[model samples]
Target: MARINVSQLKQACVDRGWLDRWLDDPATPVPMPMTPAGGIPVNGRLFHQLVAGLVQKLCVPDASAPLLALRSREQIWALLWDELAAAKVQALVRSQSAEAALHLAEALKAWCQRLAELRANCPNFKSWRSALLTHEFDLKRVAIQVSDGGVVEVSGRPDSVQVDPVHGIVVVDYKLSRGSNGTLDLLQLAIYARMLRLAKPGLNFAGLLEYYEPGLHLVPKTEAQLNAIFEHEVQPVLDRIAGHEKLMSKLKSVQVGHEAVRLSWQPKAEPDLGRDIEKAYNSFKVPVQVMGRVEAPQLVRYLIRPGLGISFAKLRSNAVNLKIQLGLHAEPLVMPGSGHVIFDVVKEKPDTVWWQDEVQRAELTAHASPLALALGVDINNRLILADLCDSNTAHALIGGSSGSGKSELLKSLVATLVKRNRPETLQLTLIDPKLLTFGGIVENAYLTGPILRDIEESLACLHLAVEDMERRYEILLAENHTRLGDRIAQGKTDLPFRVIIFDEFADLINSGREEKKEFERLTKRLSAKGRAAGVHLIIATQRPDKDVVTGQLKANLPMKICLRVTNAVNSQILLDEPGAEHLLGRGDFLSQTGSTPVRGQSLFIPQKEFLELFADKI
Candidate 1:
């Protein structure tokens, strides 16, 4: 195999956009822009400039240098390792002729295999060793950011976001290190939190800086901290640029200093093994138990790492025919109750636990109509169950991917309600932002108003519903009634509730705080007091983020309808958790009112069925 090429490494850097925003000066052997800043550059000043350039490009607009100073020890080491590894790989690939370069790749591949073996055999050192003499913290590297010159823009990504459902907004930065540097890190957190609020809608943001290593420190965002970062950290960096230009001009320095820029490399030093293991943690932090099922621990280490990406090509090849196998997939009889089969394939042992399967084989088929189960209006009208509505409340959540029959389910429910309840005793208020889900329900002649859409209109609908609720509350107070049920029992005239339904709630919240605040207020009010006022809400969405429908909203809507959510996580988010993800689409749903969920496919009424059903009326 041929030796690696230095020129080609530089070419790789250029092609990959790695050198795009660097602060490299040829006159200085070491580039100041490439080196990490310690307030002012030390060591290789020229290399420091390149590092500064990287910060400028990656940092969010209006970032404070001081606040951006604290980087996680693990991230810092990983960044450096990636840089070194990339340089090594590119050099090896471009050596000699094209054929020779291919041969060199083979050798490099073998070297990585050896490294993998060494890694596997190494003993793991826990970050925390003992109580008194803890060994968790490691000081890795410092992170800095700089402007990405052009039209000013917000530039940065939050690694993770922790939402404070109770107190508006707070941005938390998880870091390592403490004392004076920790103070600087808090300032950085302040700058980021402020920028985040300015960039998005909602309440002004707060900040939290948490350091995991050494000891814990809680840094709350304060105006003074941000000011310190701006005045001390940001201003000094700007001054450096001018200082460098003036000094360079006076000295007439036309060439970079190679010796001045060279890295502090010990001639025969081995790698820093501790930092390497932490850096090898490629996946998100997961508990050891769940880690086995969701992304096996071995896969994360060997399959996805940048250094080991090429090793995966041989993984599938290692799975050739085996003698004896473990687990259900390897069973001789391809069924759950086949029992243990010998490797000889001639003898089988009876597994008596299989009898339990036979008993439940057909009993657990989820055999019931969703509507019949939801309203407790079984075939004979016997009270097989009691619904949330019957217990003097109504609430629901509907989720479906586009064309997954979410709207169809809504229409069917409305039709069922019309058939079961009276127009005079029950009123429906439909809010369809898309203006199509309630197309079939418009002719029912029981709707309180036209479909609620525009923000102002939706808010007004909420206001009107609140007014109706308050009026009922006043009437109840006058009669000394505890609930609408009590008032109706006393022969009240306006005892019918105003059932308000919101469709495409995700889009409504998409406008931000204005709508979200209104919804939050309306939800809190209705959840706490609307049941007495005969005002209940049924909201539906296509997405299942906790931020949208919200945890508070989901909690109040105990009687929920989950229609083919993308996954089990979402199903769990809406309900307790699991069954929704497994829901067969097209109106197949899981409705939970009290405890156990009822799973069944709703009747699919075609257009002809609806047309014939309403043939005499519409």
Candidate 2:
């Protein structure tokens, strides 16, 4: 029998959808496939060596030893620098490449900086340092046989393992790569835990996946949990490999007559079938081989070569191009690094759930307690409810091109606010230059004044809002209160929450120099201090150019909702990121209230439904 390591096991699981097929039907026999012999990338090997060397030096300090106790931070830094320089020299000697050495040197500097930051911020730094010196640990390669006669052997070289009597054996593996932890890393840690448990049955074990880039990620897993994963996920796959079954069929390649082949796909009975197919094909920069077509309606299939599946990054790029060409919503379903892709044209818009839905109404009615605002359904089809006071009351900036569903989103937001609160509790100041966007809600009694359509009237309304904000602040100071919410809670004055909706803010800003400066001043003041006074602004614009959106305007508005835009530049201007350009239109948008952006599909409210909901009030 041959010896197998955790890497071999992981490769077997990933080769040609074998694991997915086995999980789908465990009784079905599958061939015992050999793991492909592929060389690890040069960068990967270097990262491994760097992590191992750092762990051996930094994580194994001995305080009781005279030489180790005399070491200061500067001395430790010098030692680390020397080790890194030696590693770089070794890499250059082996590869004869200066580029590789330079890369390694830069990585070492980054790792050193990260370590210093960790030392400064970690609360348990003292205890952690003490434990490093006192704990019994091993940092060497080990092999263990799982079954009798060595039918199954698993070998791994853990970065570090500390044997603590209180916390059992702690296995730590380092990941130098960026991004969130993946399944393979977790599985490798679990395998290490399993190997340790098998080698020393009396001792308990725990596993951790640690990263030393950007920040620290210390992920710990219990021995029982790891054992359970081994039993359910790892053991079954191993048993099947031992059984030896037939191999799964490979994907068939299509023969093309021309050097460049153009394939067309049409969804049956779909009105926009041709348009959708054109957009899908145009999305790819390089021509794709159309393997075959599926017989399902509204479905188009394309064969992706093995190990050549489109990644999310590539998909986002393609989506940006498609948005520019088609100017319509397109949702492509492709798993990162899969063997195939499907472009399904949505036949109709997603069904609209009424405000009268009992569950939805109940959720809305309960919003008074926390002052939460129901945004809409997210991309995952989950209801997105956010606290206005917490997430967006400071201010909001919205941007999208024409036909990108900005109007619909604004309408949905207003409807949500009105459905939940009475006129006495909430008031809206709506400004629509087009006059048609907010016409449906003009008759609502909650309006601070009838939706302002004239430019002068709109400007006056905004100025009044600024004055109102100042008055609220003075009231707070006089009452010895810090915030409006706090004043309201103490039963001071029942001033309704103010939400000023500015549709087509670009129109107002582009009106003249005077309007632009005045709007900028009032908006800056409101955005800076309005959240504490319970005043929020929701401003929308079709043009997101620098001159129109302006730096001063964006600096004030912290919460941004960006629908599909024309290009990456526009997307960056709107959200300070490039993802908004890749948004599928028709209210598919990215909401950025904090550092990370949340993707969601804005709720759609048909005019008929809107009229029905506000019939008596309007």
Best by TM-score: 2
Q: Which TM-score value belongs to model 2?
A: 0.54
Q: Highest lDDT: which candidate?
A: 2
CA deviation > 4 Å runs, candidate 1: 1-386, 390-393, 489-491, 607-618
**Candidate 2: RMSD over Cα atoms?**
15.5
Off by over 4 Å in 2: 1-66, 69-371, 392-394, 401-403, 440-445, 477-482, 490-493, 564-572, 575-590, 593-600, 606-618
Structure candidate 2, residue pairs in collision: 31-245
lDDT for model 1, please.
Answer: 0.43
What is the per-residue lDDT of model 1 for residues 1-618, given as tens digits with 9 covering 90 to 100?
A: 011122211221211111111112222221112222233111222222323333333244555553233234434334433643345335544643444333333333332332233233334512111100111122121122232221112233332233333322455554433433243454455445545555555746566564433234455665455545544444323232333334345445556556463211112222222232223222222111101111110011111221333232222221121112211122121101011110111012111111112112211112111112222111111112212333212566777666556876666555544444455556778889887776554354457877777777887888878888888889889888866755654556466756788888888777788788887787777766776666777788888767786788877675666767776578778777554654445555555553334443343345445444444432
Q: What's the true lDDT of residue 46 in model 2?
A: 62
TM-score of 1: 0.38
